[model samples]
Target: MTTPRRAPRRAPAALLGGATALALALAGCSTPSSGGSAAGDGTVTITVGDRPSADQAAARAIYDRRVQEFQKANPGIRIEPSETVWDVQTFQANVAGGTLPDVLKVPFTEIQALIARKQVADITDQLKEVGLADRLNPQTVKIVQGRDGRTYGVPVLPYAIGLFYNRALFEKAGLDPAKPPRTWAEVRAAAKAVAEKTGQAGYAQMATENTGGWMLTAQSYSMGGSIESEDGAKATFDDAAMRNALTLLKGMRWEDDSMGTNFLYNMNDIAKDFAAGKIGMFLSVPSAAYQAVVINFDMPKKDVGLTAVPTGPGNDNKVLSGGSVEIVNPKASEAEKSAALKWIAFFDLGKYINQEAAVADAKASAQDGGAVGIPRLSPISPEGFERYKEWIAEYVNVPLENFTGYTDNLATVQLKTEPVKSAQEVYAVLDTVLQKVLTDKGADVDALLREAVATVDTKLARAPR
Candidate 1:
């Protein structure tokens, strides 16, 4: 309900180092309950997490109002809002201690492992009963399924990596703002033009805080390479696609001199610079336009433009994707689980299917100085999404025409999830390789890939089987 400043844009959850201890702790307790208190008179009470903090008064007010409305509409269920949120460092402890709310949101990267550890509930039947199963995006929903093909969580806030450009820069460089680059070659030429004409960094790359690896992996995928094998037991990125990807970056940094002087960029630094008009183009989700350009840095909404990540020869137009999912307490009773599902449907997803909810949310966000109409991967079915968009059309504030390059190509670009095993570790390893390529003029791409293969193979060996 809030401006979506950061929840949907958070980096992947860090590696769960305490997973073994948490599993042991969970095993010791036969049944875990979210303390979803249920009364004998057929009334159920569920505790939900992710209530906005008090400092976010406007968003919090909307959330609290939704809670009250949900309770009043469904008198059979009472809602208790909790401010608990997912933090990699504290998540394991909360799960083991049974301190989590009945329902909470977590990143997609954590779903597979959570399902493996039996840390989240199987909500397949509840979803069907609540009529939410068919409403969801089938492709995105797969991320929350177990090997047995059962559901554990509901996908929300889905996003695919895309190229975000500064329209003002594009115009200043004598390029068409409506037509973004669709291939790597075009991107290179455009970056050079922006640099030569505007005296700004034509392009930038994220080079630290594990984002270096993240963006590099996305680039490699776009060039038709993968980071791990099918079962995620081996490193598989030592190939020509990855090599060429790095080679391009190396050339951009040293030969073209278009990437600017600063080589170290995490999510925040990159967003900040991009908003300040120091950079021209970069890879990120469309949410960055709202979170970075408008809300954080006060960039004019009309100046931001978004398009699909450019494809390479063998890419088939696939782009990396990730987002948030709502998981329920594995220890909850059936009644509690049902109540939790209903709450999720009403509070998290009401906007997608209900016109009133959609307009109310968008109006509030816009009025509160939050960005409206930023493009995102639809979590619901296509038909549902189209209707939702129509409902909010009047309140839409961002420049939709500037994003036609992405929205028009959305149907063609495929969405790929991140690696399934030791993802953070793989990213950490790749960060060094990307940094080397960008910062060291003579960095050897082949040698870097070979060394990474050896290091990542070792990481895969130590990962839990």
Candidate 2:
């Protein structure tokens, strides 16, 4: 596999304009209505909305299958599933207008916004009564709780970022395919060696536009850095820990030359290149393992491996978790809300549904003789774990359990609610700071960071709540 050296072409201007217009039109479609009756009898129809994903098509099939099972068990109950675009503002607009589905799938970050607008129901007691509260990951549960300590939703699945490596490249560089780097130093060293020996980019980090800052945030958190204070009311981008993280990334571009010269190669391109055997290693969600494993029907399977994101000098182990939560609308009737909760619980505990989905995801990768990561829940099945272990043993040398870390709940929550009208401005300042450090050589890291921090602080202060 080789990295696609050419930059991705931009979307046509007319297409871009049309997309903007469509988004605006959808936004305009949201308009509030007078309060309606809240009665949920057997005839009540429950509407649910969720954003589409690559796996969602299959997940939806599984969900519908379960719905059929549920309906068979309880006659007269109907579940209607709707698809929505993945945009917070548009979703909020629907919520404000009372046009939202009775139950909606939302990113954990958006829960705060929903809470602030009184758009979602408080499920704290419901969860306790159902005995599902104790089953959730505590870190995930924290993200769904309101400031007042009431639970609002349940997470169906959780995803964390990690390192995706190409075994062929590692072997070519005389590095052990079984042993991946654990610290930032090892990552740089191994990547540099691979780049030099293989004559291909060793690693690629997302440094283009707003994503550059997002990648930096992940790296910073892994180094025990925080972008804001504990309460999220204060900025801390200028702190030594963050500066150190930035310094290390800048060093990668300048000293090691392991990263691509251009920063536009995001997670998608990185996965594609790794699958094509063009790139050595990169940061990506665990799901990338599935993509790589399924890249080509005839491709040999000894190409990909998965491990936790490399550790930093201070032993900080963390990764950004991205997934959606299922929230019931406040306007939903008691019976509708109860039905929604039951559906959520059903999906969460549907071991057959989950296991089948996991197997399908893994088999998709296995077609290329590549491996995929198992969901935390799927490990509960003895047969599932045995199959997962066999698939993983084909490529990865290190134990997957050794690389896991605490998800950054604080950062996830802050980014969700942080007032920032200009995502571009915030990203630009941080990118400039990093570029200067990497290109100019020992370029007053402190001053660069302070300027970036000030810019972000101002933007944060002015963003709409």
Candidate 3:
């Protein structure tokens, strides 16, 4: 059955144009007063930012329910929640205006930039107070912890890259729906079969700039390649493992004819198309499963499947963990800080809120016959697991066996050392070189690698310790 498409929401041209004006106007403003303790009466406001998602409604419902519960538990504390669209530029403005939320959520990838600017608050002590320093998913902790050995945020949820497949297409192609690919060779073979037999695009690997080389990172890491060395001082894109990874992606796009030529489709578009069954299988985050189920609502449950990311030759099975961490603003008042930390602690320790959110996400996906894959945390109790398991079993069928193991070892694994000068510049050069290699097969890979290495080395030399 074909899913009905919703009309795309378009931003007002005037509003888009006025962003700079708004930013300038807010630039000089003092930071918002973190709601001080009302001697146990003041409200604590948490401003959260997120990418809009189909599962967001359910997630928000879960948030509201939990907040209400928390309010009841602490009658003197009022929780004010505000949602903002995830945009770095706008978030920076909010930061400048001192209107930044006391506790805010941001993408894991962007946290480095925020840390560089000293915009995010460090909450190592708060974490210790909440006894969450060790409780948090180690992989999640790694993403938010700076080179200074100080952690800046508390992770609410964690996500990992994985293969999402259309079961109907798999069956039609005479492939086993239950056994998804576990390695790159298997994936390639399966995609070829699906495309040749089913006459549909086998995969939708992202090759676009708008995604900012994220898909490349996924593919590269799947091959056990590091984007930057362990110290984060240099680009490793020219390394042997990375070359192989990039070559595989390039082969898919240029030789295999599995991917579309236009790389402009952002990750969301890719997920939407996959949900519509236009594509057979694709690499995506666990959260995309929720989106495919609710937003597209086209593909039936019997047709969807989820699996851990496929491995490559010379690569161990590893999936990059991606998600945000909640950070309390440093400038917030003691009361506000206390309240924010309290909320973070609640999220970490409160059984009801975390389980409810996961269950809601799972149910939403199940509504469309898709499986909900909660990253990092599994349901601790039978009741909590059952709440979502019924939907998962009925629609999106996947084993709930421990996938967190794959991320746990890597989560606390530092990819780079902190205070790396020219970190951004090194990344930029590396991305540019990798793009050239991926899109232009005829390009000299060795030359590009050498150039990237030189550029990174120069930056490292110039960076202050």
Name the top lDDT candidate: 1
* Cα RMSDs, all models: 8.0, 9.9, 9.7
* Alpha-carbon lDDT of model 2: 0.57
The candidate 1 region of ten consecutive residues with least summed lDDT is 11-20
lDDT of 2 at 157: 50
Error of 2 at 382 (Å): 13
Please name the candidate that would achieve the greatest TM-score relative to the true structure.
1
- Candidate 3 has a TM-score of 0.66
- Candidate 1 per-residue lDDT, tens place, 173-219, comes to 99998888999889899999999999999999887877888888898
Please count the clashing residue pairs in each candidate, in the order shown: 0, 7, 9
Question: Which has the higher TM-score value, candidate number 1 or candidate number 3?
Answer: 1
Residue-level lDDT for 43 in candidate 2: 46
Please, what are the lDDT tens digits per residue for candidate 2 over residues 1-465? 001111221212222222222223223221122223322442446776762445755555544555565554434446676675435567668867868887776664456666766778987766665446665656566667778988888766545556767778889999987777767788889889998999877877655555566556666766766666544344676876677787777677778887755456554555566676677777755443434433432223456555656667554446555456778888776556666665565544333223333333334444433333432322123343445445344434223442333122222322222111344455566667766765676688888887888877887676545
lDDT for 192 in candidate 1 is 93
How does model 2 score by TM-score? 0.71
Which has the better TM-score: candidate 2, or candidate 3? Answer: 2
lDDT of each: 0.79, 0.57, 0.57
Candidate 2 deviant stretches above 4 angstroms:
1-41, 51-70, 84-86, 116-118, 128-131, 147-149, 230-234, 289-300, 314-317, 347-444
